[model samples]
Target: MHEKLTIDIETTGLSNQDEILQLSVLDTMTDEVLFNSFLKPSHIKAWDEATKTHHITPEMVVNAPTINQIRDAVQKLLDKASLIVGYNHLNFDNRFLTKAGFRLPERQYDVMLKYSEYIKEPNKYPEGFNKTPYKWFKLVDCATNLGYDWESRPHDSASDARATSWCYRKLAEIN
Candidate 1:
């Protein structure tokens, strides 16, 4: 059976050394949350900048499970998923997941890239240099554009994963 999974991860920062602060995965077809949890960072002592964007503080994940503890289960979900979907996941979330020792499936869908092309939002770049690229949309913006109402905070991994799945479905309808 082919399974589509939507995943999202929050990290300390956009660096190879940044630890994953949270991870969420959902069944795209059924919208079932397969996994959702805050992860305690292994090395980082602070994440003020990331906290500002995601609102996940150190204290929030103090007693959370470490990545190693949940690696096997998450990897199993990844292995079962035929296509993993996320917003800007190709550029961001996957990198963090790979760095944290999770193996991702080869089949993946980047909702941000596809939705940007669909909306025809131009990227901020000089004109007449080359072909213009589409501006990636945030998960919240994509969800809002598709009339998806938030049930919880936006930056939370579970919330982001849900939004990504919803956006993917909405975009699929118009595609």
Candidate 2:
């Protein structure tokens, strides 16, 4: 069966130096959770803002495995997936994975980009006026727009992964 993996990550910060606090991967075709875990941080410190967003505390990851320890298993899941997808993965999640030394597959899809194209509003202008308009939607916003309700807390990697998978399915139906 052709399988696509939808992933979501909670991180310590936005930069490359940041650590991935949590990782979630789900099989889109089967709705199966392939892998999910809170990674023990080795270098970066989690910021308050990040903690506020993902709610991943240091105590939560105190007994979790580090990325280095789980890299092989994570790679196995990735290798099995025909395509790896996420809401804003290309810009965010992939960077953290790369920084953590995980080699990713080239077949990647960004649900946010697909949703953007699916919901884009054409600019309207008065006579003799010209402008290009754009609309950007966050994962939660997109999920809400598509009538996706979270089964668990938002920002938790597994919950976010499930939500993203739902969004991807919805977007696929429309497109």
Best by TM-score: 1
Q: How many backbone clashes does candidate 2 have?
A: 0
What tens digits encode model 2's per-residue C-alpha lDDT throughout 41-111? 99865567789888888889989999999999988888777888798888778888888888788898888
Tell me the number of clashing residue pairs for each predicted model.
0, 0
lDDT of 2 at 5: 89
Return the lDDT, model 2, position 171: 85
Q: Which stretches of candidate 1 lie over 4 Å from their true place?
A: 126-132
C-alpha TM-score for every candidate: 0.93, 0.89
lDDT of 2: 0.82
lDDT on C-alpha atoms for all candidate structures:
0.88, 0.82
- Pairs with steric clashes in candidate 1: none
Per-residue lDDT of model 1, residues 95-121, tens digit only:
888888888999999998898889886
